[model samples]
Target: MAQMIVRNIEDSVKTGLKARASLHGWSMEEEVRHILREAVNQPPPARTKLGSRISGRFAGAGLLEPLPELHAQTIEPMVLGE
Candidate 1:
């Protein structure tokens, strides 16, 4: 049912795709279609960004030291809704 045409592909990339598809016993078209479908359907990896992933690895483990009293007091007023 696919009738749409794509344009402007480089020949070498297409050749590589065809070679890979043939190795898997699939036609280039079928392989491409499968790949497109998989790309759309698959969930992205659970963690992607470096900062969030690193933070997540140590989440709630009490590894970081608790704040000292004077520093905590200095910061607390800024956040407190008087």
Candidate 2:
């Protein structure tokens, strides 16, 4: 077992980690080790092109209707500045 010294930690972050560690009945070191293990084991998010996920979910939902023009240059400012 190796030891580590994490530096430059904020006071609030230390407090938060202590609370979380106590909640799980684990020392902060054990809690952090468990977290690292779980994080390393999960698969990365699948890569997809823009709108591909939504396209299948809304297949019959009217092709998402045309997205309203979001061009800021075309919109006129309704109110004048003070």
Q: Which residue pairs overlap in candidate 1's backbone? A: none
* Worst window of 10 by summed lDDT in candidate 1: 68-77
Q: What TM-score number comes out for model 2?
A: 0.55
lDDT of candidate 1 at residue 63, scale 0 to 100: 70
Predicted candidate 2 versus true structure: per-residue lDDT over 24-54, tens digit per residue = 9999878878888899999999998778987
After superposition, the stretches of candidate 1 with alpha carbons farther than 4 Å from their true spots are 47-82
Question: How far in Å is the alpha carbon of 31 misplaced in model 2?
Answer: 0.9
Q: What tens-digit string does per-residue lDDT give for candidate 1 at 1-82?
A: 7576779989998999899899989899888888889999998977679977877888898878854456434443356676
